[model samples]
Target: MDVDARLRELGLELPEPMTPAGNYLPAKAAGDLLYLSGMGPIRPDGTLVAGKVGDGGLDLDTAREAARLTGLQMLAAMRAELGDLDRVRSVVKLFGMVNCRPGFTRTPAVIDGCSDLLVAVLGDRGRGARSAVGMAELPFDIAVEIEAVVQVAP
Candidate 1:
């Protein structure tokens, strides 16, 4: 099944590509791989998610949800670029960053937000190696940010 069909089955819909707020490209094609830049938890309405892990009144659960939303936004950007999600062969790498208090201890859980979504959306093929780390803050005060390395059909 293709991505459109899967979206139908999953009762999900892709959002419009999130407009880059700066000069950088949203995604870059490197041979058969697409490297997406770290992006915020952007909503379909074109606004970034607003919260900070263990800060700004956001707890771990809220932080994780933001990460999940970031993952979905990443997929939406990829789908727009490739025209189809099935073109994805393997998800090679994922990097997540969480904006949190100075000594928060939920990096792994925050990263799980993205990992779980990939498995749900692309099954085993979408699962990948990942790294999640905490930072003093993130761009736009986003609770989480995520980027992906996707192997695409030639």
Candidate 2:
């Protein structure tokens, strides 16, 4: 299916590309690969969903949602970088980091939120290798952060 149709079917709207908080570019392309910087769970309104997962303030489901949102944000960045979502050939890899309370071991499940959304939007092209790990803390104390590598059409 076309990307737009998929997005609409999923009831998802891509937000405006987020501005980089640091000096690095949000995304960069090299040959067929587009690399995105790590992005946190900031909403469309520019507010962060900040907290540690498995903590009282953020639960697994919420962190999972945050991962999904982070995926969308990365897609927004990709669109901004490539000028069109159709330029994407496939998702290549994803690295996810969760800021969580001590002893939280369900990082992979939380990161699935992102993986599932990508597949929903891009079908088989979204399937890719991934790594999900917990961190003692993340920038802004956001519940989850993720980065991606995508292979784009020439």
Best by TM-score: 2
Q: 38-120, model 1: which lDDT tens digit per residue?
A: 88887667666676666456887767777777878888889878887899998999998888887788899988977887788
Q: What is the lDDT of residue 14 in candidate 2?
A: 94
**Each model's Cα RMSD:** 1.5, 1.1
lDDT to native, each model: 0.82, 0.90
Query: Whole-model lDDT for model 1 versus the true structure?
Result: 0.82
Runs in model 1 lying further than 4 Å from the true structure:
none
Clash number for model 1? 0
- Cα lDDT tens digits, model 2, 1-154, are 5788778888899988778888999999999999999997777787888898885768989889899889899888988998888888999999999998898999999999999999989999999999999999898788888999999998
Deviation of model 1 at 145, angstroms? 1.0
